[model samples]
Target: MEKFFHFVSQTGFSNIEVSSLVMLVIGLFLLYLGIAKKYEPLLLVPIGFGILLVNFPLSPLMVQPENGQPGGLLYYLYMGIELGIYPPLIFMGVGALTDFSPLISNPKTLLLGAAAQIGIFGTFLSMLMLGFTDLEAASIGIIGGADGPTAIYLSSQMAPHLLGAVSVAAYSYMALVPIIQPPIMRLLTTKDERRIVMEELRETTRRERILFPVIGILVTGLFLPESLPLLGMLMLGNLFRECGVVDRLSKAAQNELNNIVVIFLGLTVGAKCTASHFLTFETILILVFGLVAFAIGTATGVLMGKVMCKATGGKVNPLIGAAGVSAVPMSARVCQAVGQKENPSNFLLMFAMGPNVGGVIGSAIAAGIFLAVL
Candidate 1:
């Protein structure tokens, strides 16, 4: 009995405690949100499961070995996240799936994307005042960009220890955009503004479509080399799609490659949520800052849209500006839904896509700026 007890104590299971149990419950809640609520399931489900696995008492999945070296599945998974491999791979898939024509047709929408980034910078300054170092605060601020991959990529580089909290915060707010953004959207715009109608988008030329990805690569590469891993891969995927010669490659990048990377990325991110790392005063602070970042981003986008609306004599729906957060089609969809609520005939989706894609590029640039400056 004594020998058996000693052996058990040497393993991870013996270390199971109340904190671990709490983490397990949190993981299950995340899983429930993903599976039942359909809240960012592609990432949340895997990450939720990973959280459960890592938090299970003495699970070897997250503990260090007797030799004092890191041990378990999570350790290995974390390597990919730490090295910053998963996000760029995900970007390649995003590039393949994204259509640039909507953006090209309404290039002026790029300003909304730029304006939305004000939240990221704003949050950075706020976090610094709250006592986080420049780099750590910058990572926290990026939650406003509303781009999960970019948030993860920048956090991995700038403040790796905060990865679990920052990533969870970024993705959670993204999933809640419909909830969080609508109230702000309604508050910021008048009913008449929401009901405004715009002309249909003009058809984009094939040459323009073909030229976009190339220009994106050159401009991003020249201006922000640090962004190339993401921008380059993203643009490459777009080129494959627009070139019209690599249907197989485009399909593979969008479907197979995307699905696989998301799984790895989600699981690895969840692994970072070990109880010791997650249950802290700092974690709570990070969550608070994340919400602020997102709110500011939404408000900035909407305000910019209002400005554009006045500038364009109501031709631009300020609500479409809120879609600039790079939550991709989701933000755009929210803009469409809200617009339809005010005016059933109003279709803002195509116009929203301009800032939607621009938001992606904007977040990447923001990440690069953080890397360069902070």
Candidate 2:
């Protein structure tokens, strides 16, 4: 009876706490959302599983193993995040996959991307007002960029302790782009502004495609050397795609390599949500502020779009400005859906891509700027 009692007590059920139970439930909810709702399954699924694994009592998957036991698999996988490796690799893959022709053809839209970064800085200031330290505020602010890897990268550098909250907030908002950006977009833009159609993008010359990455690197590097690590990898990936000579490298970067890295990155990030770290008042605040940041980013982008619309004599659709949040194709797609509702014949997807890709550049630049200034 004594041995039986001891063994049973050793199990997770005996060791569980209210916080761990809550985290477990949250992890399950994430799994359901990923599996059934199809909410970013590639990311959410792995992350949800990681969260589940780490929450179990004495699970070998969490960090700093107790009692001198070896750190678990997750602890090692987390090193990629801790060492700041996965985000850059993720950026490289993004660059390989992204089609920047729209941005190249419509260069002015870059301003929309830049305008959208107001969310990052705005959130930074807001967090500071709320009494977060500079590093924590800076880490939280990057979530506004709506770029998960950038958020993770900045947090890892500035505030490693806040990684779980910031990462979850960044990715959650990114997945909810469809739900969050639309209402704000509609509320801010006129029906006519949403309905406007633009001219087709001019065919980008091979020379322009080839020169863009190189020039982008030089210009950005000169301005913000601190950003070179993330920006350099991103531009290099794009160069592989645009060079027309590295089909194998481009294919690997965008496909196989990307897939493998995402699994590691997602799982490791999720594991960071150990109940002790994630279930705090500050974590709640981070979540709330993350939403505010994204909303501000969208509003600012659309307002900039409105300005551009008037300046260009109605060539620009204010809706496309919302794509400046750097959520990649997702934000751009939201622009398309909202625009089509206003004008069924208006195909804004391609046009939206201009600011969409530009937002990626904008977010990285913002991250770099934060790294430099803070």
- Each candidate's number of clashing pairs is 2, 0
Model 2, residue 120: distance off in Å is 0.9
- TM-score against native, each model: 0.95, 0.97
lDDT of 1 at 355: 90
**Candidate 1: segments with Cα more than 4 A from true spot:** 1-14, 63-71
Which candidate number would show the highest lDDT if scored against the true structure? 2
Candidate 2 global lDDT: 0.92
Predicted candidate 1 versus true structure: per-residue lDDT over 276-364, tens digit per residue: 88998888988898899888888899899999999988899999889888898799999999999988978888889989998898889
Please give the lDDT score for candidate 1: 0.89
Task: Sum up the clashes in candidate 1.
Answer: 2
Candidate 2 stretches with Cα past 4 Å from truth are 65-69
52-132 per-residue lDDT for model 2 (tens digits): 999998787765767878878989889999999999999899999998889998899999999999999999999999999
Return the TM-score for candidate 1, rounded to 2 decimals.
Answer: 0.95
